[model samples]
Target: MSLLPHLHRLPSRVILASASPRKRELLSSLLSPLPALVKGINLEIIPSTFAENLSKDGKTAAAYARLTASAKGKEVFDRCCGEKDKAVLVISADTVVESPAGDVLEKPSNKQHATSMMQQLSGEWHAVHTGVCLMLQSSSGNMIETTFSTTTKVRFAQLSPEVIDAYTDTVEPYDKAGGYGIQTAGLGGSLVEEISGCYFNVVGFPIRSFVQALIELLDKVKDKDDS
Candidate 1:
């Protein structure tokens, strides 16, 4: 059975609650092939306002990502779920890099910081953890929320100080988690030697895991409606 048809049955306004262009493009690429099914989906892009300041204290890398993702989803869900007659579904995600030393590396603050982050990653195996959250609000105001995290083990090729310095001089590192994007065409792409898990997760969104979760969530909603 085609999943598109199952997705078409969802009578909800779908929202991508993040401003990351990578994520938006990734999702649009997924749905672009299904014109009929895409038409049926009322999709909107609304960036969440949640401060990504949650501490990773007492939490694993996956848990931290999940927590941040849930907060982002909830922020947008509360703002958009005003219409009682229409169901609303909000999707949000967060990505973080865990260094070999058990440090959670976020986007770098400056070139020096970017250089430092890249240096830490050079010739080292790091974990890229992406957390995804789905917030579903039925027409009756009942809500269902699901959050999960996936980690991709990425190993950086051995880099010299000059190589790291050259890459950090560019504008790519500041906006990306871990001061590097594995999918970037520039030096960033050359940084990674291999990854052991979902490639999309490192890019920002875990589409495969997300589709499974979305289908399962929709099934739950269908069952709830039937009952």
Candidate 2:
């Protein structure tokens, strides 16, 4: 049985609390062998005032990712908790790029910003962190939340000004966290040196880690029911 069928067998429905196209594609691929059973809640990514604050513990990348995902999950859960559905599981995720210099690079806003980010990332190894949150509405309508995160090390080949300009001209780097998409034709194979971890994590979602986390959460929920 596929992932969706396995999930459907549970006593509730699965809800993805995000509006990202990449995440939707990843989830569809993961659930392809089963009947489509998951739904998505389109939630906006609000600018959090706390997003810019670096964690004093030095885990800035992981900390911001978790906080962002948790905020999104909670927002969606708050809106859907009163439903009569047997169970509603909401998944929210956030991804960020951390430079070796310890600076966090968010999505670029324009061509100039993209150019600047590309300059900083050129010939450097950076870390990509994605935080995932799973929130479930219990049979009794109470919400329970669990969070986990994954990090991938990525290295970019040295890029010339011409190449960066060419890439930025065609691709919409403004929508991507690092001013480049590792899955896109122009960027993935040609510009990236290598990846030390999950490739999908760099694309926007970390499917393998996410699946593991989801299964673990489900197991815990089942154990509670058994007890």
Candidate 3:
């Protein structure tokens, strides 16, 4: 079933709680392909300032991703609640890279940090985890929340120190997790020889999993509506 029918019935807008261009572009692309499903649906881009202060501790990588995504979603959802008009649906997500040895890697702080991350990833396998959260409030004030995480395993092609240093100098790794972006047209994609799961997950959002979650979320409320 398509989310359009359900989404169209509600007098609400979809808000994405992120400022990253990649995320905004991806979200727009995801919805654009289904024009009939999302036509006339208001799209709001609201970036959240929620600090990612969640420490590693004993929490697993997926757990951390979900925690951060939930926090971000709630942060934005609360902000939208102040409005008096239509309902709101807020979407949020967080991504991280986990080493074969189980260490979680977030965005590198500096060039040196990115250099270290590349060194650890050279010729090794790492898992990318993305947590996604969807919170929706109907026009009548009914609310629903859904959360999930997806994992993708990526194997790096053996990279030399020179390559890592040169790539870091290009200024792409600092803002991305694991000090690299899987979508880098040349520099980044060349480093990973293969990946095991959803390709989009490594790009910071799991498109396939997200679609399924949305359907299930709407389906639940859909059932209630039918009853």
Residue-level lDDT of model 3, residues 82-115, one tens digit each, is 3463466789999999987899999999888888
The model with the greatest lDDT is 1
Q: Candidate 3: global Cα-lDDT?
A: 0.82
Model 2 C-alpha lDDT versus the unseen true structure? 0.74
lDDT of 2 by residue, 107-159 (tens): 88889988888888899899999988887665655555789889999999999
**Candidate 3, RMSD to the unseen true structure:** 2.2
List pairs with backbone clashes in candidate 1.
none
Q: What does the lDDT read for residue 154 in candidate 3?
A: 98
Instruction: Give the winner by TM-score: 1 or 3.
Output: 1
- Model 1 scores worst on lDDT over the 10 consecutive residues at 1-10
- Model 1: lDDT of residue 21: 94
After superposing candidate 1, which stretches have Cα over 4 Å from the reference? 36-42, 82-85
Better of 1 and 2 by lDDT: 1
lDDT of 3 at 101: 86
- Residue 107, candidate 1: Cα error in Å is 0.7
